[model samples]
Target chain A: MTELRLMWRNTRMVVLCAISAALYAAVLVPFKVVPLIPGVTELRPANAIPIVCSFLFGPAAAWGSAIGNMIGDFFGGVSPGDLFGFFANLFYGFIPYKIWEIISRGEGPVIRSPWIAVKYFAACLAASVLCADFVGWGDNLLALRPFSLLGNVIIFNNMASAMLLSPFILAAVYPRVRRGRMLYEELMPEIKPAPMPRKTLGLALLVAGEVGAWITGNLLSTGYWTPGFLPAWMAAAPYDKSVAMIVSPFMLLAVVGLCLM
Target chain B: MKTTLYIERDSFVHRLHPTAKVFGLFVVFWSIYWVDNPLALMPLALIVLAIALMMGAWENVYRFRWFFILIIVPTMLTWMLFYRVGKPLITLPPFYVSEASLMFGFGRGLKVGALVLASVLFLSGTKVEELAVGLSRLGLPYRLGFTITLAFRLVPLFMESALTVVDAQRLRGYDFDAGGPFERIRRYVPVVVPVFMGALRKANNMAMALEARGFGRTHRPTSFIEYRMHPRDAAAFAFLLALGAVSFWIYYSGLGAIPTG
Candidate 1:
């Protein structure tokens, strides 16, 4: 998180951020022709760029992901919900490298072994779930879209690209980026890892919060589970109030956990 | 490839200060967010339509005609499935189409559509540099703004580079469209790798160029383009405030909500 702020001070990180964002928007704009859900979202192979950039550029990638998505939205159309979309994408790009750092210990994201592959999948899933939860929560709260619709679709969309496309891209480019001394670790050696105990706790909290929000958001939005505690007025269809009340704490937990990390 | 939705124009909307335009965008979204009834959303839609016509932005609107339809139609259908209330006019297994549900669905669709249309109107009239300046006027960090403008500039270059790579690959008889969806996506691996590597090769030199020019020497770098607030900007701000107020008043009066029961 500190790196997110400090990266702006370095000219190289700023340029890297621009490059990452440009690369993402470049891929994103052309793929608008392939709609997955027809206007709600598309078959975004560009989703892979964030994860790939995350492993390579770290904090710059996070900002890049946010900006790139904004650029994409600008092309299609934008709404108030896109403000949330922006942050959701920020975490989408941020979580991968951060989570990988915690889970991979010293392993690169090139996916050399079965264990590393599993870890890679886990990292992608965590990033995807949190990204989905944030967008779902925000849209539902605004009564723009049901949580279940966006929540499930985004997870599938992100994971598909992360799993299918990111590995090959990273494999092809990571060695070159590392050799060029452009990897975030090489460029920003000043950033230190959090203590293992704190980061582990952060990972636990992040996973708990994200997964909890995802399930709870789906159930509430689909009207599968209505809590006894909510007033009747809050338990109606659209479920915006219900979602705001129930899912927000879990989202907060994830943010807090991310901060701790 | 055309990277932005901005139409070259010198209409009053186009001449407005970037901050005013940015504020106008926020005001439109705020107004739309408080209303869920299609009829209530109609006024905002009409206003956006009027602006588009005034700005001669039909090209961008026509470009996104299918997208607008896609957004409204699918949203209506999805909401119809979830919003079950009132006397059922038609029951189709999992979906109930009642007056209440129909109104709710249509309202949601219109809301989403109007939001997109408003953004389209904004982008049509405002340039990328104007957007960055507007956002900066609204308190965005200078570096972040620079990054955004820089990313906007880079997207088309990257897209052009990607096309060149695609052309080279096609010449070698690589079939991109001949595979299943997953395999088709995998084919992009070759296309992405070269563009990615090419982008990374520039990052080091780009960073060096920025530092050489003393990019971060001052917290508030002087802009080459200056925007002074005019009387029209004040009037625009007042009108936007009124728009936001009227929409909130519609909600406060219970006129913007879908009728239920």
Candidate 2:
């Protein structure tokens, strides 16, 4: 029993990883509201779960987070990226864990901040973005077809989605997790949190939102929402056509202007 | 004894690379689309089944045998009625089953069923790693290859998570297996929410872990998992080439000779 206690003590880390997988899969798939939620668009934030898991429990836990979500999502009949979706999620899990222990530990306020909570929050958020990119590229390459994972449309949608959703989650969960208050009774005492200027998080959100809006307009207005799914020219169809109509003179002007110039 | 959908064996088909298997499947699918002669397609389908058997995939076939049987019965009846539609040999009040219609339906169904089974044969047997290896070999990048491998690796992990979640629900007095569709759906929320949450957490952790690690550190790293092509691989590749040639020949030889299933 005592042996089990020692084992179970940190095993919750795996459970945390599992929960992370399930949530990402559920929010992105089976339930429609995730997309409806506005900015939490891409499957990349899901990367954060494995990131934290890797930090706390190592590779196995991180992997578990990736795999666990796929299984959960499949049984739920989530959107069909088929095999590509599952693959990106798995390898991406290792990224965050490896980063913290290997490289990022020496960097910035991330390491020096008195409260470990904000540090963890930021770490996970970063992990998710990188993985999301992995999903986009990997999906196109592996599937031999574009638009499997994030593709341009979803990736653009996800960027908007991430800014809106990530911070709230970071704020709500980071303090408890960072302080170690989430551990089972007997793990350890909670760590103190560091003070931050008020509304700093708000400013981050504001900036992210503006950027998201700008990109969405540019990407969507083109009427070609595909990055990999559709060729850039094809994806730029609506924009091209609309812009063509808007600037049809360029065609006639190009011949005369180039000749004149 | 059960000549079910999946044919488990240790023949050349089984020995084929997972990537090759995927390619083969696609070729078969493409062939089906091109061949209008159902009869000719039947033989090809049978050949695929035979190859599957040679590969020692009978166990997998047996698992889905009942499903095929269920499909076959309905299909046979529909074809029989269709083939005899105008000449209805039997008539009942408010329900007249035509022999022509029955024959047509049966034939249509058998063709579809056989194809579905053939697909199942491939899906159940091929390991995801093999697929990744194949795709990578076929020009997918290492990142994509690893992504596919990682995805395949996650399947078992998610399955295990699911079992635990089921057990947890059981402990909480939730009846997951036995219920009406609505009940089944409602029960799923508990299952889904928890599972989705699990995935989300993992994605975050993984991203952080990856960043911490040196993933995407350089353009590309030397591959540790290398697949060298030997003479046997060349021979197999040649055989597929020949198969493609024959398929093209059949297409060009004449559309009329293709038999209808």
Candidate 3:
């Protein structure tokens, strides 16, 4: 009951985390637009979102984000892997949450303790990469076919990807979240009669969603040339996915409603 | 490329119970594997294709039909010509085309190609939300079911955002119009780094939004969309199940003949 009240008290913060997680999952459709490069990989970013979600929001958040991203996978026409689909994302996507869980238990926050973040970072990174690779390899082994070396190729590439990517999601947003938590503590000292403007709230959500999406789209693809083709091969590898891209709007809106929390 | 299994339209395949069709697909696929003779596979493929076509995916077929034809013809030719290991039906010195090989090749090609088509037809024809709902009805947790539905909606949204991100970079005088593929990739570094960071921010926000809406605990959701089982759906399920049984029997009993022997 106390934890529930605490969640209710910081409901706004938690809800934002969920929405962020949903949008994190939501965008990234694999629609086969022009690629910026010829052979550059895309899946790493897809893996990042859920990890980030789990890191910030807690266990429920982690699972929520993974389920969201999986939906995108389903629609993007992921058919061949069969039941392997169930845990494929879980193995790769659950790393950051686990790491964050460990980190959160330390003396201070993950950001202040950069070494704390780094301590298990390598193991976490290696674990996720290997988990993903083994799943792929297992699929081939089951099929009684020659194994693919592509898994190793991907693992090698992700080293730079992790070093470059993980910090920002870990550092910037998380601190803001912690600060936001601080703000939540400051503002909602007790549940006062806060003016709940339903219409105003709806319009705010609309504007925020559109504007946030526009900024994200424009900010990410800063100009590179690739000739457009009809059969646009989807080039998004793994790292580019997020929460907004996947989970249901009804659920998301509810989370958004919690921002009213 | 991510697989394309959805077939877009309001036909029987579109309307059939999502669970049944999922099972139906599995049944058809196993039948493809079970039938020892390749000749028997074609009819099963044809039946799936017919269902997909009847479901209103004619346009998608026209779009990918050439690609399919190209793949099937070449594979058939290669299998019959190169993998020929038996007594020659037609010999060219060291290279010989045997009756068994030819039959095997055709059967393999037809089965594989038809399976591919069946998959494409399924994805292109099916509405993603309906599929999620069906899964939920089939006993997927409602939370997970809704997550799948939301993620489906997000794919296109993100695809569009990715493009918009590219254009935003172009306007900022980012050298998208760079020479050589490598140069273009370097240019996209600026684009990708930020788009990715921005997406994380979005996910964080989305998670928070969802949690705010009284989402964590079980609350009776006011579902805005509804799908009900109808007579047409029942009939399709019964007929397809029967067809699947027949296919299974034929494959196992070897009543189905292949042209090879």
Q: State which candidate has the highest DockQ.
A: 1
For each candidate, report its DockQ versus the true two-chain complex. Answer: 0.82, 0.06, 0.08
Clashes of each: 0, 102, 81
Model 1: residue B40 alpha-carbon error in angstroms? 1.5
Scored by TM-score, the top model is 1
Q: What is the TM-score of candidate 1?
A: 0.99
Worst 10 residues of 2 chain A by lDDT: A140-149
- Badly placed stretches (over 4 Å) of model 2 are A1-261, B1-11, B14-19, B36-38, B70-104, B141-144, B177-179, B245-261
* Alpha-carbon runs more than 4 Å astray in model 1: none
Q: Of 1 and 3, which scores higher on TM-score? A: 1
Q: Candidate 3: which docking quality band?
A: incorrect
* Candidate 1: residue pairs that collide: none
Task: Report, to 2 decimal places, the DockQ of model 2.
Answer: 0.06
How far residue A70's Cα lies from its native spot in candidate 2, in Å, is: 10
Q: Chain A only: give the TM-score of model 2.
A: 0.43
Candidate 3 residue spans exceeding 4 A from truth: A1-54, A57-69, A80-82, A99-121, A141-160, A163-174, A181-261, B1-8, B33-38, B64-116, B175-222, B254-261
Q: Is the docking of candidate 2 incorrect, acceptable, medium or high quality?
A: incorrect
Share of native interface contacts present in candidate 1: 0.81
- Candidate 1: which docking quality band? high
